[model samples]
Structure formats: C-alpha cells, structure tokens
Target: MTPGRVIAGPGGGIPWDLPRDRAHFRAYTSGKWMLVGRKTYEEMEGWFGNRTPLILTRDPSFVAPVPSHRVVGSIFEAIELAKRNGIGELVISGGAEVYETALPYADRLVLTTVETEIESDIHFPECRDPENWTAIHREVWPSDEENDFEIILQILDRKSR
Candidate 1:
C-alpha cells in the first residue's frame, strides 16, 4: 500500500538514529532537504564535510560554525529555499520543534518506534486519530546488545489524500 504522496513525488519520513541531525540530512539530502534545528545545524558541519546545508532559526545573532550553511529566520523560509531547489523530496529530521512545526505539512510518516523507550527530555507527538493515517508497512528489528528492546518501523499515510 502507498503510505503517502504518489509513492515517489513530494516527501517521506524515515525513522533513524544518529547522534546529530546533520548525518540524517547529509545521508538523505542528495535529494534536497532542510535540517530543522540548531544542534542539527552544528552536527552537520563536522559530519557533512563541506556540503551546503540550510538551517532554520529565528535568532538573528545565531552564528553557524560553517559558512556552507545559512540560518533562515523561519521554517517557511527554509522550506521555500528547499522547494526552490526543485529536487523532488524533502526530509524533515527533527529536534521536536521542527517535527511539530512540519507535521501538518506531511502526508506520510516514516516512523521508527525505537526498540527501547528513551528517557528523552523531549518526545515526538503521538498520532491520536488512527483514522487520519494508517501503517501501510512495518518492520521489527533488535535494538542492540545494550538494549533489550525491539524497534518498529511504520510507514503511515494520510487517509484523505
């Protein structure tokens, strides 16, 4: 089943774990994506080498470690710049705020319910209405020797579109 979009056009979500969000953008953005957080921005510089990244931040004095990236004033501007690239897909890698901000824009969710419940200071919002979306595809994987939990991958699609 199609989890979202036309199955190819627009954007899709994938559940992944990287110490920094930059790795996610670098690994994914050969397709054009916007890294949506301050830490995600910092992590990209060292991890992505010299690839240009677009960072979204409202703070005016936010100085980036690398000039290959620019801090945009808003998510709208960041997305607009990414759209201008005309690359067919965008990945919204999160740090909570970015995910919440972009959730309304997504038609599909590439989700990974981690094998272990992380004691995170922040958490991803839950989908309360199952009718709004469906898990078209799912997979289970072992977390690792350190973790006894199992991770679940779910691809969810919007019902109406």
Candidate 2:
C-alpha cells in the first residue's frame, strides 16, 4: 500500500486527491493477499474486493467481516500464518504503528513521495540508511487536474544484513 509522503494529513489519515496513486495501488494490490492493520482495514470501504485480507489486531475477540479473511494478534503470528500458507512475498500494508513494527523485516517498500507537503501527525518512517535500503526503481508523476499533487514512486529493497 502507498502511504502519503507526509504519511497522512492533519486528520491523522490520508486526505488527498490522488487518482494516479489509486491506479498505482490497484495495479500492485489486485489479486494479492494484503497484510493490513485493524484500523487500516476498518478505514477501507468496499475497496480491495479482489484481494484476500489478513487483519492484524491485538484483540483476540475481534471478528472479521468475511469468513475468508483471517485475524491474528501479532505480526509474528501473521508471518507464521503467511509462511504456513506458502506465501512467498509478503507485503505489509499499514498504519504508522504497523509500519514501524514491520520495518526491520520488510524486504521491499513501495514508497510514493507525494509532492505537496501537508500537516500530518502520522509519518512514514525514514528508511534512507544506505546500509539497509537501496532504491531499485524510481518514477516521477507530474501533478495534473485529476490529481492535484505530483508523486514520485520508488521501490526500495532491503539489503542483506
């Protein structure tokens, strides 16, 4: 999932018009299993219909809307479940807390640098340490009438430690 460059807006959530980002999001997530935080899952409304969802929440009594979806209490449990299901490449989509939790283990990150800066309480963690990350791909999207902000999409791969 693509987090805003500033992570989120003043409301502590992403609040911007980004059609191109939406397109990019669909392109990557379509027909894939998504590992998402509970809050993030709740924020979505009828979106991501094509993907399987694994919701991570600390509440053991939590229930999922669909029977096909699974809920786990910890990231470790999620990882274990993903492994048992033979999920080869895991994608950790997030809320800031979950992003921070997954940072050390994340093999790759799809970062979309939103051009315009806006106030935000939540922020994406800095991953610029050359020893840990290396940019594998980069593309710049200019702003347009449809999307009010320009964005730079970058793919970062974690270096073998």
Candidate 3:
C-alpha cells in the first residue's frame, strides 16, 4: 500500500513494481493458508506455489481452477475451513472489500507502505488506531535497482483488550 493507503490504482492494478516487496510477501506467505477475494484470487492466479488459497465469493457456481483451492462464502467460513484443516495461521491477502470485511478479526497486519502516492480507487481499510494496534516490527528499505521506491515494511499486532 502507498502512503495514502492506496492499494491498487484507478485501473484496478498495483501501480508500483517492487521486487523486494514481492519477495518479502512470498517469503512470509509461502506455505501458508491465504484468504482472498474472488478478483484478487483471479489476479494472483498461478502465484500460489506451495500456499493454499481460500477464495471468498458469493457465487455458488464459482469453482477454483486448482483442485487444492477452496471457495468459501464468508470470512468466518474460511476461518472454519482453515481450522478444520489444522492451519495455525491464515493470511488475508485482499482486494478492498475483503480487507474491510476481515479487519475486525485480524490479529496481526503485515503491511508495506510505499513512499509515494498514486491515483487509486481502491484503498486499504484504516486499522492504525493506536489503541487497537501496536507496531511490533518495522524495517525501512531504500530504493534499489529492482525496486523503484523506498518502502516501510511493518508488522502490527492487535492490542489485547
């Protein structure tokens, strides 16, 4: 996401190409159970590798291309499925709506804040309330040959009530 919280540009695609960020994402998400919206799932097709995808969609007729992928109706259902599969952690990789819907139940948030802002229709939901979350980890990376912009990678954990 950008400094403005923009996740995807007006064209409904990510504006920046950051290989370092991509590698970071893959490092944390590989072999994990990922929950994503239908559009996000389609956009990220063939990128799953060893990870399992739980696609959230209201369409009952929608079927996943991969035999291992699961289509679920809601976030809770996705959680239940992951629990049944003995998954200890579920990663929420999202489009806008999915992020908004899952925000309440999120225990931790892994975020990459790009230094620049771009024109975007999709924005990540606000979850930065100081009372609700604490930044447990953060790393600042400067632009490199592979990455166009500086980025702040952060891990925020939900504060206990």
Most lDDT-accurate candidate: 3
lDDT accuracy of residue 1 in candidate 3: 92
lDDT of each: 0.57, 0.80, 0.93
Name model 2 segments beyond 4 Å from true: 1-5
Residues 16-134, candidate 1, lDDT per residue (tens digit)? Answer: 34333323335544534555577555544465453455677878999877666667777778768767877455567665667768777777786655543332335555555668997
- Highest TM-score, which number? 3
Error of 2 at 158 (Å): 1.1
Candidate 2 residue lDDT tens string, 50-110: 7878899989899998888889888888889989998876677787878988887888888
Backbone clashes in candidate 2 total 0
- How do the candidates rank by lDDT, highest first? 3, 2, 1
> Candidate 2 lDDT (Cα, whole model)?
0.80
For all candidates, what are the clash counts?
2, 0, 0
Give me candidate 2's TM-score against the actual structure: 0.91
